[model samples]
Target: MAASAYSDHPELCVKDNFKQSNFKRRIQVQCDLLKEDQCSAFTAISHSDKAIILSFRGSEEDEVTMEVVDAITVLPVTEFSGKAKVNQYFYDAFNDLWNAGIKNDFLSLKNANPGYELWVTGHSLGAAMASLAATTLVTTKIFPADKIKLVTFGQPRVGDKTYAELIDSIIPYAYRVIHKNDLVANIPPQFLYGYHHHKSEVWYNNDMTKGQPYLECDEDESKKCSDSVIDLSIPDHSMYYNVTGSFASNGCKGWNVFTQ
Candidate 1:
């Protein structure tokens, strides 16, 4: 798929201001799932189209907590327990949200929308949750594996080789969008922890100007892909929609990019 096709959806998913009081003013349906110290997510029907979007929010004040969650390594998908495993923390967080009613709400919205498509997305931690949710939905038969469109920004590796193969085969339209030097995309380091990413990565160059190259690397764990490298700085991870003149202008604070 073209970069334009995948890029547009994530832009919409990450652009929301997330003001709870007036969330409906921004998106059609706002279903908030926040458990202090657990997980955070919201499901909304698009204001302009018939798409049901489930977006996850990254660590706000608990960076250390999220880091710990990332270190939990792989755990099997509850349904396919012995056969497939995913990042334990991401799956746990997503499981919390699913149990809290995202599944029912998602089905209700799908039935109401009739012909609308289902889109699952997020950035950083949200991206991880989105990946978990997308994969789980497929395994549970809540939604057809082929119908879910997943586009994540700054998403970390969410599973091992088996989990990656399962999702890559089931979700053909899954796109992992990584921007230049986005450090979050590189963790929990594949070499150190045996984590792996799904196929079809859309990598954007550091340049913000038009005509900058966006390459789609087909290898599942190639060094040519962004996740294979490590750069501690998080500026590029949060620069999907907003492009700063230079890294100095934003730096690690780029996490604020999506909200504005």
Candidate 2:
């Protein structure tokens, strides 16, 4: 296809360009379980030539041990829940670590590579961190403000309506992925808040509407909501490898696949 021909059809051109650009990006992730004083934590950093994803798992238990348990305690939980105090602490922790990681990467890449894009993703608490990191990246101009994307899976409500809107405004590609019946999504942050203003969709399991956590209100908000959000219930709350697509796959195993 000629360049002029593509320019005439801008949407097609952009899609084609993104598809081609996906292969040029590099993928880098760091997973670590650390112990400090009386707490145990897990942190994972997944980056690509185009984007970056950082996740931190909370303590497995109240004891000081290095173990990554898949229980609710070990995952990231958003703020604005009934337990506001605990939620804020985790949110601040994720922000501090994420900012450090992003600053390191952004500074290192600033001189040699000036225009790389960015995206952040995570399952639960990780998802909330990813969203906040994405916003922070744009707000600080560490990455291209318009190029930042957020894909959160089964993320609890991070904040109220204003916070969600602030997040959405910083990046154009913010997307929150919800499963069909996953109860974690509805825990606290009700859907009416402004912070949940970004694009959202439901990921189905076997059937379209059978067994997954579903977000019913995003359609009325996002002008371009996807048909599905990719059901994360199949393998429990971990949808790390299922998201597939140039923008999503990032070479992950299952939940990373992009589903239309």
1-260: candidate 1 lDDT, tens digit per residue: 11111231323323342222111111111222333454455556664555667766554434634454545544434335565666666677776767677677777777777776677877776688788888877877777876688988878888777778888888878888888877777777777456788877888766444556777887687678675455655667656645421222222233344233
Best by TM-score: 1
The TM-scores, one per candidate, come to 0.73, 0.52
What is the overall TM-score of model 2 with all chains considered together? 0.52
Alpha carbon lDDT of residue 110, candidate 1?
74
Q: Model 1 — TM-score against the truth? A: 0.73
For 1-260, candidate 2 gives per-residue lDDT tens digits of: 11111022222322333333211112222323343411111221223344332332322123212221222234334443232222343356555564445456444544444465544555555565566666666655657767665666656566555566566555667666654544444434333222233445444432233233433444323423322332324233333233212222122223212332
Evaluated against the true structure, the overall lDDT of model 2 is 0.41
Best by lDDT: 1
